[model samples]
Target: MRLVLLSLLLVLAGCQAPASNQASQPKVPTFYNHWELFAIDAVKVPRLKPAQRLDVDRNYMVSGMAGCNRVFGQGKFEAGVLTFENLSTTMKICPAELDRYEQSITEVLSNDPKVTMYRGDLVLRANHRVLQYRLVKETSSQ
Candidate 1:
């Protein structure tokens, strides 16, 4: 009886899946979710851009002014927590127009792997960096 019960408990635990596993199965990004200078390239460099209207329902994404070179791979978040596999940025000589994105995304990704989004602002923290993001005024969730 004891052996049977132990086996059943193990089976039950194995059947249970964590939230992260469940969240990644679909892996679709919502509006203003995980907005980075990296993602759909919403930031127009020197000037920030809105993400509520940004569409990232594709394989590859390109945003920013023109030659931003700042981008990232597909990422998924479960219940508002970010998970990154690997992010690749350009090694090219970025002009002054695209410098903001390089700095911004680098600062963002270097900090923390976790973020919190409220209203139009996003708070991202990793190691020593804390980032505050303001979404487009019109798309405020508040």
Candidate 2:
């Protein structure tokens, strides 16, 4: 009887054991949300009157305002890298500085960027450029 109890206890313990494949488990993408560009290459992004944000959905679709133009595209995220395909942007003429910023942003997005989450910030690295974005929390006003 004692041996049976010991065997039963061992079975229960085995059942409760944490999964051994935890490390190999697929990483859940936490970058799916509204994000605002905070910095580029360690420098603060130029202030823009309009909304400067990027929205990434679970389907990997991306859309946002990059400084002066509105950008939309289908994105593919895999193995910690994000790449956009056929990215299209509005051709609205913008101020020289904002236009420059927009160009830089598009360039970064065009290149497959390595993505990492650091201290709650989404960091993208591509072509020696680091683009940092902060999550924009949505608030419900009743």
Candidate 3:
């Protein structure tokens, strides 16, 4: 009788679920997916002539176009935290105002930002800014 009870208790323990928080943690989206900037700080993003966008790959590489310049760097996403490193951009000159916007984007990307999804939009929050991006559907050519 004692052996049976011990075995039952061990099986019960093994069957128990994990902690609530652990079970409830949001699943990280596939970071390798492509996305396009949609808005910043709740403001509609200005249309860029060259189309600013971001693309991340499984190899920890990030590439994007920032208004007027091509940008690429190393980036990592873990546990909902996104971080960029060693980002470099082309020196091409854009409009003064657009250049400022580009700088802001680079600054945010280089920081340790918290990433979340809202209403099918990928939102990145850092400091006092919130950037929202929409998933970019893959083209058949790619």
Candidate 4:
């Protein structure tokens, strides 16, 4: 009886071992895709009527909306760091609040920002500002 009980316990222990080992590997976050800015500097930004979004492809080309203007540029992401260059926006007037918001976003994008992932959201920190974006899912027109 004792031998059987010991063998049973060992088998159960072996089964649980793999479960713990599988969870030991942590998930690494990747940002080579599209995301939407949901908050700036910790303040929630309401979704725009026509939708504002940011796209960063595998080639690191940056294109998106900044307030009421269209923004396009080149970006680099390596070693967990991100930076944008030559960012240009369309010459369009916007509401005072949106213009201010655009300034804050462009300011960060123009400089190098520390990037991290929190609760599945991509976060960028720079110039005493924090930009939090949520991943945008791709939809097919079909």
Candidate 3 residue-wise lDDT, 1-142, digit = tens: 9999999999877776566657897787665667788888888887776777888777658788876888889877788888766778888988986786687677677677788888877787887788788888653433
Cα lDDT tens digits for candidate 1, 24-46 = 78533344433433232332333
Whole-model lDDT values for every prediction: 0.47, 0.82, 0.77, 0.80
Per TM-score, the best of the predicted structures is 2
Q: Any idea what lDDT model 4 has?
A: 0.80
The ten-residue window of minimal lDDT in model 3 covers 133-142
Query: How high is the lDDT of residue 47 in model 1?
Result: 39
Put down candidate 2 lDDT per residue, 70-111, tens digits, no spaces: 999998988999988688899899998787778778888889
The TM-score measured for candidate 3 stands at: 0.75
Stronger candidate by lDDT (3 vs 4)? 4
Q: How high is each candidate's TM-score?
A: 0.43, 0.82, 0.75, 0.72
After the best TM-score superposition of candidate 2, give how far the Cα of residue 133 lies from its true spot, in angstroms: 0.9
**Model 1 pairs whose backbones collide:** 111-126, 112-125, 112-126
Model 1 ranges with Cα > 4 A deviation:
1-67, 95-101, 110-112, 137-142
